[model samples]
Target: MTAGLSRRAAICGIGQTEFSKESGRTELQLACECVKSALDDAGLSPADVDGLVTFTMDTTEEIDVVRNLGIGELSMFSRVPYGGGAAAGTVLQAAMAVATGVADVVVCYRAFNERSGMRFGGFASTLTSMPLFLSWYGPYGLLTPASWVALHARRYMETYGVTNADFAPIAVVDRKHAATNPDAWFHGRPITVEDHQASRWIVEPVLRLLDCCQESDGGVAIVVTSTERARDLRQVPAVIEAAAQGATFDGESMTSYYRDDLTGLQEMGAVARRLWSMSGLSPDDIQTAFLYDHFTPFVLMQLEELGFCGRGEAKEFATVENLSIGGRLPINTNGGLLGEAYIHGMNGITEGVRQVRGTSHNQVDAVEHVLVTSGTGVPTSGLILGRD
Candidate 1:
């Protein structure tokens, strides 16, 4: 077996800008703001940074970040793709860099003006990534992310006797956590199952408006360094117990429609296999979790895919008493994408760091390890974070 990079690196600091509909600034400014904030939190300066990582979709380039931050020559400048799937992969990249001596002190960031700028909620012809699906969907007026996810939701619900009601607890508890998080854009706006049922349908008979995540304008960044080095830094290190990125066969950019089984996140399943093997930890060991909430149905799929519950058993497992702050496994305590602003899942990583640091607004007690995932459906990645 390979000596994986488990506990080789740790997230020394996490930072984010305020979640808002309109930041009234360029994406570059937002990126710099969060990176600087993260460095400040890590007791490091811009010059201490030698590596940088980000999403392929981010508007701010790596060189731009280096120039703006006055960071010197970088040994590593990499980008991860597949939108939200790249969230945890960024840290995976940084952990590898630090472990292999590629660089020291890396910062992973995602910043966007998605709401006041280019919105991801609505469909755009520019997204020709899934050519075959786009051709079929375009002619049938099936546009937007909700409709794309609706394709899988329909099959999942039909195959497993699931419904929109089965998905409401995730949305309800997410907003409930968001209601307490002051940084959450939807703070103070907790919703009930009745409210979720009353919301308008974004995709008929499948997804409601509340089931979809918000198109937010914000930025979040994480500072990574060797675990030994992190101990001397300003804050407690959220150690990288196991960092993994997985992309199974027959996966596309935004859709995994052609997979043999349309009911589960197979790529995330691939990630889970690596995580468990590397960390030597199981679902039972996870104190809390941050399953990607770009959509709520995927949250259920994630619970099953990660082996927290058996396949098709999430319908019974997804209760407020189960997933709440005092439950068997609290999830998305910072409200998640549905409640917090979607920095394309980067904000979820920051919250995982917070939970590990014991600084979260809805902090779970005795959190020895926190499981954080990237996007579902397509090629995805996940991380098992723990206290160092």
Candidate 2:
């Protein structure tokens, strides 16, 4: 399938910050205020950014946010490691550095305070300076991340009986689209299925503290140029029709623990079959989605590894539609990372550039296309975005 690449690269700008646990600032001032509000929403400044991409568990660096956003000359910069699976591979490394001219506007960011400052669910042993294959599962307890997603949600509920009320309809459809998304930190707090069977578990029959995801501070950014300079910039572009990153065999960043099939994520099914064969589109042309809910059973194992429900039938297609707000597909409407605010997926790629720029709060009506995924049992990435 892979036929779509025509050197496109859009998403002219998008920014974020206010999802907080306490952004009393500094993760380099939430990465220079989300890279100066994504270069003031791409009316361009910081001298039209030269290029930068982020996340190797970002702590704000890329020449210190290009010497604190007084940006100038940087042809290209990059980073992408497993945490939150490098959120759409930082806009696929700024759309392959602006579709190969090697950088024009670029920028892609992430910032963090992660719950007032470094808390990744606090449980440290400092794995003896990691990497010796994470010192064989950091001395067995598999450290945190809810016990490495409760060992693949207990082998996907013993090879698919998938219960805990089928992952409580993906945390009740991401807190019912984060209760109408007032930049959701469970904005207006929605949830039920008896509030995910009376929340709090954290890792028993798979997870709960509302099925994880929080501890945010904030920062998000986007820009990436070229689709004819993002059709004369300042918004509505969003194109980059496909981008992927995958890692399957022996992949480990969230500890793959010698996979055989811990209920399928196979690096997001190898980034959803290379993002539906490089965006020649499928999954019914994606009218909106954002997958990486950070925990909620890896958002039903990434909707059955992005074929949108079939492996174990993604908990019966997320309890018969209601994937929140008039759902057939509508996911993470901006309340992902289970109720929006997990800088690691860069605010779900800024809500997939606001659902291809029709601008979302929970808007999913005609959304041309929009897949956006990342952070699913590690070594993952995906993106599709559309509306050119």
Candidate 3:
């Protein structure tokens, strides 16, 4: 079922810049700094990094980073498209390179001034470079990520009788975890369901302000290498038990309206199947999850898509006691795109690594396998990580 890349590559290091509205530096600096931080965490230097991967939306060029970090001739350099969806795909690219001997060590990074320079949530007058699927929605005034997601969110809510209230717990739990994470932008700031209900609607009847993730200015990076090489490095390695990327039939970016239904993320389901097949693990084996929480309703959809719950049952499965740290399946312990900084889901992967290392601030108990997912409503990707 797999190409035999599973567990051959492991994430050895993780690092990031402060989650903030303003970093006061160029995205290039943020990119270089985070890579250096990850390299430091892995006890490796720039020269040791022979491969690199990042998002197409990222402003920092590969050559600039390579030159700034003093990295030597690179064997592999890749750019995964699809904003938010490229998070785990970056790991997939790095892993494939490492597993096939194309490169020995690879660093995956993402950097942007989302809040200060280019806000992902802001209305785009003309995004010519956006995915072709997204252009379809612009004619209807779906000019922002929030507006685009609102279409599916409203459809899912209507199909299942789900309400705006059911999505509040996700935000509450994320902020609860962020309240304890010193590095989170919303650190020490936890909100309640009542607060979420009171928050003004971003897309009325579909999403509220609290339900939307912050547009953060930050950078995050991960180091991938052979399991053998990772074991000999600094931190405990988060073995890549499995990694997968999927784009479903008729799937479109943000607006997957052409599918059989709008209730579930078909692409995410495809990714879940491959992760299960490649890892030889079932949903019951996942001790924790680092789900992408760009929107709370999507978090619920991801839970169902990942097989954590039956379709339409996520409304009941996502409880305060359950999503919390000592619960059946704690998630987003480092805060998430919602409560932490939204570095296009790269921060979620970093938190997954911390969970595997058993060093997370809101660490779960005996985390054996951590499930990390990319964005929803798009060609998404996912990863299954475990202790080596």
Candidate 4:
């Protein structure tokens, strides 16, 4: 097993504002509210917080959040890149800082007004920086994220003999889980495979309307500190068993079209290898998972990449019986991004903490270890959280 930084830190607090289509509050306000709530949940004050971490895509600056929340004397602050892929990476940064004593009481947060303010699925007003790669695909109408992923999804179907009908189970299961979760936007509203098939096509033959995650406006924060200190805190410590970020050969933003295989996420596979090594635990050890579900096809790819099932077997494995509670592996108990609100994946980490703490609305029996992953098709990250 890989050594050095396993089980050094733990998440003692998780807090979030209500998920909504329109928060009616500034992103800064949403950020500060979650940060304060997380600190409160950890039985800590802003004065005790010494570090901060977030995504580079986040508009709320660290200094701005610190100043707004009255946090004093920041010792460490950092940001990860690649949009939603930075979710678990933020916690990795905080855990590393706390583990090495670079900082204590580190808080990782993500707050955005995605739905009501700026939608990721919407057209960009202007190009901030045009990389050379954009010249190849941008002119061909491969503009939005859905279109980018649809290109990969079509190739995956042809390579694996996977079909559009195969993706129905994923959507059905996610909404099934979300139906019981009151916090989910689709709470009490479950969809079937028929419902999935009836949904309008976003791209074509691959991505349907129900397959994409919601553009949500919300905020989520996690408090990380030493396990020793966390035991004395308000919540049960979800120990950081392992954490890692990975990018495979010839990786590009989401346009890694040059890879030998489009059916698998080699980047997440690299992350899986490190997590198991560092934590001294395999996929068998995990009782639950919060696999990033930004897109249904990517969820299947993650299942294969993370080794929960064999390559090209994710569709067969993504059954309602398999994904439900009391089944082999329960995923996205909080409804995932598709059913739940997307706080740029910070909410997924919060759900992982809930699993470890045995407090999920759809709580699995005796969940000692929970696996969480960030966005796929980019430089991504993953984490293993276990009971302390």
Candidate 5:
């Protein structure tokens, strides 16, 4: 039997602003723009919305967005933490609200002028109070996000005997997909494995400029309602099969190096287990995946943790032909964060919906189940979305 929450909620609409390096607008403005578009897509007036979910790190407040968008009084509002890791949690929270009747017509959104306003990659030092772990590691020159993820990426390579060549295929395939996606920042500009090999190093031995996701500026918003109500909406419903958040023991934000094995993502493993159980679907059920690719190495690790492939096999499983539009499990069909714009993984959720709706520009054939994971190597979340 399907769980009450599993098929109760469906994504009725998705909207976003153009991805860019500099939006030249306030975070509030961007948030409002996306929410307005999402509501319009759902054929909902702002007054019809009663719930809101967003990232804790988002600069715009819930009230600010609601007021600006002319949304009526809200019965539910929530915020998820841990930067990109909170992506799926936003929808999960909204689904919960809609499923239990805590609210109807929930809007989940994330917005920022990350590149032009506050660059996360450019952030260094503990300006205020430091994270206890960062205080210990920060002085040792572990400052930027690239350097932080590099620690785990380096250890993963050593454990699995993965080389730069193994990592090149991921970038190559993502860029290939992006080349066909006009909205992707790197669209129309596919790269070769040789190109990935030649890119300048961001952090030695693992990440290169090509491996890192764009520091983009934009917003994405999703509309969630009961599957029953969704059927009355304008678009095909992307039912929420499962939604879960997980953090393993001793879990830190991004620098979760204290885990037993750096070769895989334990937090993502927890989410995968719950998602499979809650959705009554295994790895075999997923036709496409929107694995978070903020960094390339984690994408491989996510494949392993999510049970798409066994441990130590992700290096080989990540191939251009194997993961392309016609591949068995086409991934990041909207070009992912690497190719498309990075709206802190919210864009991935949108792409998942597109795949289910058969409206993606890089549409995968016969897509019934789409798996999407948030930031790996951190306290993360995952969602299983499928056609209703």
Candidate 6:
């Protein structure tokens, strides 16, 4: 076991630009805005920042952000790859930096114009030209995310007898939470199981258009510092009880089709094992879950992989009041990527902080520990946020 770090890191500040399909702004501008907001929220200035972490996919680089934001010297700077999988990993990097005294204050951020500028869902031929690994799958008609995930979803249905209706409750519950959250992209728009069933199919027997997340253009950021120092910050510190990133054997980005198990998120399973072991908490201790909802089926799969339910039991768990607000475990009170803006899971981390602060728009009563996960069907990451 890699012994846990001694000093606990806590998120003392959170900030984000409005979640939307079209922000009409440059990615750099969005990054600066969010960085400034987070700094202000932390009751600190740009000069106080000594570390920075962001996604490798992010267009805004560290030097550019530092110069643009008028930030001073930085002691540590790094980036994680694999798009949405880097969400919690960015925070993990920041927290590690702060905990080790390599930096006093660190910020993790992600910003993009994914919708109006460059829609990721729209298939592009460039993927075929990228690398040999992607080339192998591109020629096989596994060109789109939905198509790649469909294969696994089909296998899951075949093995578990799960159906489209079984995935409906995930969307229904997230939309219900979104309906009450003014910041949510789907605010005031609650859906029923009928709505999920009625939505147009994106992939046969696997997903519908509504079952997938939106292409949002915005930015979200979080500030990390030692829990002791965070006590004097502006907001109630959301302690980082544990943070972990995991990639399972034979991991292949979003298209991990070669894995021995098609129905499980082994990468996420690895993250869950480390998170629970380090945090000394179990599924029963989680007050709410912010599992990645890039697709509804993946949400069910995550419930199973994270040990919230047994394998092939997530559909039953969802139907048996395990996923509702008043049920055993509420999930995605921020509406998730399905009903909320999808900033590649950055928004999910912000929601985890809100729950810890007891200020979430869809606040769960007496939230102590919240589990926030990154993108599934890939090398993913997770965080256990708790009250300090």
Clashing pairs in 6: none
List TM-score per model, in order: 0.97, 0.34, 0.97, 0.97, 0.97, 0.97
User: Candidate 6 lDDT, tens digit per residue, 108-155?
Assistant: 999999988777777464553645655866677677787778887888
Instruction: Name every residue pair that clashes in candidate 2.
Output: none
RMSD of 3: 1.6
Candidate 5, residue 266: CA error in Å? 0.7
The true-versus-predicted C-alpha distance at residue 140 of model 2, in Å, is 47
Give the Cα error of residue 164 in candidate 3, in Å. Answer: 0.3
Clash pairs (backbone) in predicted model 1: none
- Model 2 TM-score, 2 decimals: 0.34
Worst 10 residues of 2 by lDDT: 1-10
Off by over 4 Å in 3: 1-3, 125-135
Clashes of 6: 0
**Best model per lDDT:** 3
Taking every candidate in turn, the Cα RMSD to the unseen true structure, in Å, is: 1.7, 17.9, 1.6, 1.5, 1.5, 1.6
Q: Report every candidate's CA lDDT.
A: 0.90, 0.80, 0.91, 0.90, 0.89, 0.88
Candidate 5 local lDDT, 241-357, one digit each (tens): 999999889877888877687777888989998899999999888899999999999898888889888899988898888888788678898888888988999999999999999
Candidate 4's C-alpha runs over 4 A off are 125-133
Better of 2 and 3 by lDDT: 3
Model 2, position 266: C-alpha lDDT score: 89
lDDT of 4 at 388: 90
lDDT tens string, model 1, 296-375? 89899899989999999999999988999999889999999999888888888889999999999999999999999998
